[model samples]
Target: MKVGVVDVGSNTVRLLVASVGSGEVRSLEEGRAHLGLGEEILLHGRIRRRKLDELDAVVTEFARIARKHRVRELETVVTAPGRQGGESERLLEVLRRATDGPVRVVSAENEGRLAYTGAVARTSVGPGVVAVCDVGGGSTEIVVGTALLGPAWVRSVDIGSLRLTASLLHGNPPTRTEVESARASIREAFSGIAPPAPELALATGGSARAIARIVGGAYDAE
Candidate 1:
């Protein structure tokens, strides 16, 4: 079936159209609008009415794009914003009106699972243990498993780049002290859990891609 999926993330609203069949999904088209909902959430502890209206408009346009592509089904999924923001029902109502299809907030576990499967599906990773990390705007999801067995462990850390920046890094080019404070916050967020070692570790997210452009697409302890 040809399906259109709308991802409502804290940093942006994205649309992905694809053909799903025979255990594969082929991308047809993609689009996104950066709304920076995380910053609002950090400031107000909830999504304001104005932002909700903006979200509705974006989703409506995305739905139109999906129809233009002749998709059989269009579904919307909310990520960190839905989990962290207050008055989630108001958000859901707005999305349901805009897309006129399925709309729901994705659970943290499922978010990790989808991130793992989506990343691993596009890579040439072997059937050994693999780990995938998605650093979203309001949270980060980590999944560990093999491509064959699927995710065995999933965890979501409730701190991401946007939140950290809005909460700690006030300067445009954050000062050294601010950078260190952000690093310390990140460390504290992940201090509780230890993930199993994997044969390969994959990072896939907006921040990851942006950093890859500057750091040559690879990461290591520096």
Candidate 2:
């Protein structure tokens, strides 16, 4: 069956159109756009018209691609953007019009679990009490479970790279102060985090992979 997944985040919007089933899945189309939905909302409590326009474009494009792929069912998932109030309704209305489809306002915890299931289906790491972290432009989710996939606990924090970058870091490499501040905030959120008695942690996010690539690149350039 053809399935489409759209994640409307704080900094960007993304679409994943794929064909799935029978233990096999392939992405037929994907799209992304920078909308900055959480910029002013983090500071204030609303989204600006400029950012709304950006989101419209992203949603329109995603709609086109999904139609082009002839997807049967499209499932769009939205996180904190809808619950933030202050301006969530307006933004959601705009996006719904852009696609003329249902937009699901998923709780942070549920979003975390779904995303983990999707990603882990692609790659399940070493056997143990697996702790999964999926971070986006607006929130970070941590799920702890056993090798048998029994539930342990799930947590969601409102801190993403863009959120940190805007509120704290403003440089490409981010200053020491910014990094330290960001770390402090993340620690506060994960203060109770114990990793479900796991041996190691599994981190999944653009920030993690990008940092890894850049570090490797720097070493190779030497």
lDDT of 2 by residue, 9-42 (tens): 7766889999989988898888887667777688
Q: Write the per-residue lDDT of candidate 1 for residues 1-222, one digit (tens) a residue.
A: 899999999899999999999998899999999999988888998889999899989999999999999999999999988889888888899999999999989998999999998899899999899999999999999999999999999999999989998999998899999999999999999997899998889998999999889988766656
- Model 1 error, position 165 (Å): 0.7
Task: Name the weakest run of 10 consecutive residues (lDDT summed) in model 1.
Answer: 213-222
Query: Alpha carbon lDDT of residue 119, candidate 2?
Result: 53
List lDDT for all candidates, in order: 0.92, 0.76
Which residue pairs in candidate 1 collide? none
Instruction: Compute each candidate's TM-score over C-alphas.
Output: 0.96, 0.86
Q: For each candidate in turn, give its C-alpha RMSD to the true structure in angstroms.
A: 1.3, 3.7
Candidate of highest TM-score: 1
Query: What TM-score quantifies how close candidate 1 is to the native fold?
Result: 0.96
lDDT of 2 at 27: 84
